[model samples]
Target chain A: MATTVESPGIRREWQRFTPRQRLIRYAFYLVAVAALIQSINSVDIIPEFLEDAPAQIVDLFARMWPVDWAYYPKTVHAALIETLHIATLGTVLALIMAVPVALMVATNITRWPALRLLGKFILVSSRSVNSLVWALLFVAVFGPGGLAGTLAIAFRSVGFVGKLLAEALEEAHKGPVEALTATGAPWLSLMLKAYWPQVQPSFWSIALFRWDINIRESAVLGLVGAGGIGMALDDALNLLYWDQVALTLLTIFSVVIAAEIIVTYIRSKII
Target chain B: MSTAASQPVAATRQNPFPVNWGARLGWVALVAYSFYAASLFELTWERFVVGLDNGAKFIGRMLPPLLGKWDLLSKGLLESLEISIIATVIGVAVAMPIGLLAARNLMPAWVTWPTRGLIAMCRSFHPVIVAILFVKAVGFGALAGIMALIVASIGFIAKLFAEAIEEISLKQVEAVRATGAGFGNVLIMAVQPQVLARFIGFSTYQLDSNLRNSTMVGIVGGGGIGSTLFTAFQRFDYDFVLTILICIISMIMIGEIVSGWVRKAFQ
Candidate 1:
């Protein structure tokens, strides 16, 4: 089973590296270890921060005696609806924005290499940032509300969907596209007739997948004042209302699970 | 005039392909909607101009970053790094086994379904939300942060790694199993070799992600640099805030490099 394949020169050179090179690497590791040890020996200022925690924890949990069964009903109604709406809107918006750009970013689709590079650059920079960072930035601009949450979630979704779809497009079966092009079809026609159909399933599944993530993300955007159940959760925590916190956590967990199941069902049906 | 009239007939005869009217119309609609949406978002010239000035002022205030508070800075950095590393290790270790067990192509329905559900549950919340829950559950500080990130890590890495596993070549696996090898033996010899390089890639990527996330988990009082950075912002200590931001970016970039190196070495 040991089949002999020709070793490319670059790989051969890599395999022939000397021991001196290895020793230098070990020296670098030693320095890193020393610096790490110095950092660890630094005093824990964390104790000062935790000094007030005992009182806060006690006070926070004190009011949790009888569960707020009435408040639970309210949470189930309004807050649940808002979280779903935000996630749905964000998914719709991101899909709309991602499709065309994903086509442009796909290396095989875009005839002009420069355009593909620029599109990929835009996608990379956009996606490198996490959704929470985007939420914080939008909160500053849009002022704490659902709009900010929507924009933040949608912005990140664009990046996620775009990158994934672009990759799908890249990995598509080339035979159909080549055949279409050989028949003197226009570039757009080649893509529409060949590339789109092959990659569409993956794109659909990824979008459905994003929906599951977005629901959870939308729940927390409220913590940063972007508006949702998170705002309620934040308030409950600050005031040390464990019963309310418990209620919010329960709602989020169930909604997220339900959303996940629905998404799983949809992706299965679609793909 | 007669030649010009004849030219129209020649052009029509030469160019026989009919334009796709529906697609053209769709493109037009997309452009119009994008413009309308931009307007609705107030992404106007005036806003852009004012925003530039405001950003300049913010940058100006942050120009001279205060490194004088080395003690606090160093402590926070170390804590954040520890939180990230610990989370990455625990998260990846937990995720790898579960991810393998959850791969639809390899595992039975009963095992795959539950594992997939567990991953989805873990992944549902953003790290910050998870951190909030953990803080409430375990009490505040580094412990909460670690737990939150561990959950987040499991959710993300497991789902993706499982997908990677599921997408791998069944032919190669079948070839190994054809030699009358046991399931464990086949997985070790056949499955692991096919997926190991990619799994390493995923693990390193997760570590890099955990580093970035670790910085923010503290914003919810989970622990690390986020709480420190948040406090500095609230106090309008712009210089200190800038310093922290710079340090975070640098640390993340370094983490990215380290992750890359790890992947290269393992591969």
Candidate 2:
């Protein structure tokens, strides 16, 4: 505790945190540390591998030093293009699918509580499972192609886009909606005229953001034969073609950077 | 009625809905590209119908999901939980210093630049890709999954931490410094108080994300329920796959609820 003297006879004391809060904080820290210790104990780490990790990393890097640039024109290029297409198409598809879901989820838009719960459940299911897992499911049904990759990306993004879009719709200005209602506007017209404009900026922003994520995701979908650069990377990895692996990794990196820049630029311009 | 009134009405009747050529062109380009991409992928109506039919059968097979492989499923699930916990702990510990160094407000430009670049590189790849690399380096196990998730946690939480630090009120920092306090003391007294809540929030969020990712790293043999799920998929064990998926989703949902409670408590 720190104390300040107001007078010689009367001193005031100050404390940073209340005793209860301090206790809570300490308990949280204790739990975290205990969890960490328990997990570390349970996760088996072979000591020899741990000891040689540095050497192994160095050896791996050495093998990847001279990347096979020749692999690009042969296979990597087509895969990269397919990845971009999947991301773009998937984003568009997700936006289309998410609009109805968003409407259902937005409490102000959808009056039914059960529907809202159902919409939330749909969103959660979409989001909880990783896109890779969705890709696995779609790949099974669609038989391992760009279509499966696209569907996975679309399904995953439906949750993200729908959640944000619903929030935006919920926060729409009430005045316009009231005015629309006074004029006896139909539900469709009310949604279009009042809610659409209010959420347009955020909708585009969400779309672009999800599109950027989809690019990175689609790039890796090929690992499960869902079609994209990931398939090429998977092939190289399996063959232990370090140079090709390095090249594929570099391509994925550059593409990710490019997508980020493009999304940022578009978002600034649009929103 | 009057000629002057009629003239004013005619002048006021200008077009209210002006077309934006730029937006129209963008939409056009998007639609065109979508068409081209669909054709490229042979995504015709027939293909979609066929997919739907296949999906119907798939769902039918997945119904009443099998939970008979409790031993295997539990093992994988436990391994994923352990991986996420260890990764989050190590990653957050490692990220703190990196985040401090990367904060432009707190560090020199030289220190911030390379550190920011490293964060960007860490963020560039998906965690699975990183897991693949780690699997190659570490000879495939929970170690590789843990390392992959550690990288992801650092990339995510460190960037947000650095940003949060940058947004701190410098006035508090200056006042602390004016008291002749050392750098460490100033950070503890001024910076930590401002960012601790947010740091905790980011950490919990990262833990949730790491948990989600840990389940998937096993796809690349880094170790988790994902390898088992993948194997199940290959064997056409659709019911088992559904069981695994339900378990994963429920686990994540529970994690989300717990993290939400933690965040509220801290706040």
Candidate 3:
């Protein structure tokens, strides 16, 4: 005769049906409703705000029309170049700085535990703040320009690339690395012969992806006085030159599309 | 595998990295150019030393973040929370269809190309830049900020979603299709299960990011605590700035904890 015993899955189901699960579920539902209620109150959409809002909307659109198309050629070239410069330099430098740091950070790659902890700390601190915050800090310290913008992008890229590369490194197959080591290859040779090949495709794609993000970010660094297309756009807005604003938007939109095409083509080649 | 002494460096470099003088020179030039670029940027110790005092002063001002205007800050914070939630919910909801259409493996080139292009254009902008555009288009307010972030949310989540769809186990999808199931049915039965966790994960991440961004967008007059923070900065209310920073940091950390809890519950 078998003793009365519940299977693990049945035991789990029984636990879910217990009073504790029911209480937790109910509590969760209550909190969600409360949050939704809070949102409704905060927006203050009780008809008064909506009434005046429509007129403002109409006025805004009227002002937006008849955009100054002529402003495009003058503004696009210089600002676009600066933005590209910042992004390209940032990505290249980041790739350079990231490799050794990633190797050091990865638990499997870096045998020494202490060094790994230090690398992780470095990555966390660098990544903790957003790039805009970094731009703000650098702007205050170094006076605002493309240099500050580049630094902000580069520092953030380091954190991003290092963390991602380390994870990829950790997930790489160990057999090849061990084989190279067993054959008395030097550490550098082991990396070049074994590890890099496996991770290169992913690394290239991530780098290109970051480059696209950095370009967009670089454009906006000017808001903090860090310099780029953003500065010109900021000037246009402040002056209430709606036409110029429209022109700027069109330029940025077109350039961004072009960039996306380039990145897609490059990614296809690499992948 | 020869002895280290017997093996020629030429053999190792031959296939992948040609040992031509041109390649070696290219490597040398790259290293030299990098160092040259660094120096041109004026990243000097002297400048850093001079800035320390100013930095200290700035930090000092940010102290005891004055919560004197508690009502204003609390109200703004609430609005920000709403904007983030609404944007995440709507954006993620819309991304489902668009992402489905854009995945190359799932859709034909005609459908994928245009959808992909739209996502790319959306992705190509920072929320702040997008906010500025929306402000110009729709006028400055919470609405502009909301619209901007919604576009941002779509740009990111949909692309990741499309990639996720592309990476799904086609075997399962094919099996469902083999059962004479329509596209929608195959997606529901096979694709959704594989990608549900990632979609949830992306949405949570987007929400967290949106919360942080919601604050910044207000600096450009997009509405939320950022507007208040900008005012404080402009008024030279350094202490208030400090207070706002503390509040923002706490808010984000709380968001992280809450999102983590949500994920845990769902899983």
Top of the candidates by DockQ: 2
What is the per-residue lDDT of model 1 for residues A1-271, given as tens digits with 9 covering 90 to 100?
A: 2344456653322333367655654664574456445434542335544565567556646756455656666654566666666676777788888888898988777889888888777676566666766676666555567667777888888878999998999999989988888899997788777887798799779878898889988898877777778877777778877788777877888888888789889887877
Task: Write one digit per residue (lDDT tens) for candidate 2, span A68-137.
Answer: 9999999999999999999999999999899999999998988999999999998988999899999999
lDDT of 2: 0.92
DockQ of each: 0.16, 0.75, 0.31
List clashing residue pairs in candidate 1: none
Worst 10 residues of 3 chain A by lDDT: A9-18
> Evaluated with lDDT, which candidate comes out highest?
2
Estimate, for each residue in A65-171, the C-alpha lDDT of model 3 and write its tens digit.
88887776787567767777777777778888888889999888789999998888777667656677667766665777777787788887888899999988899
User: Candidate 3, which CAPRI tier?
Assistant: acceptable
TM-score of chain A of each: 0.78, 0.94, 0.85
Docking level for model 1: incorrect
What does candidate 2's lDDT look like per residue over B85-186, in tens digits? 999988999999999999999999999999999998889899999999998788778999999999988888889989999999999999999999999999
lDDT of 1 by residue, B126-196 (tens): 78877876676566788778878899889989998899888889998889888999998988988887887
Better of 2 and 3 by lDDT: 2
Best-to-worst DockQ order: 2, 3, 1
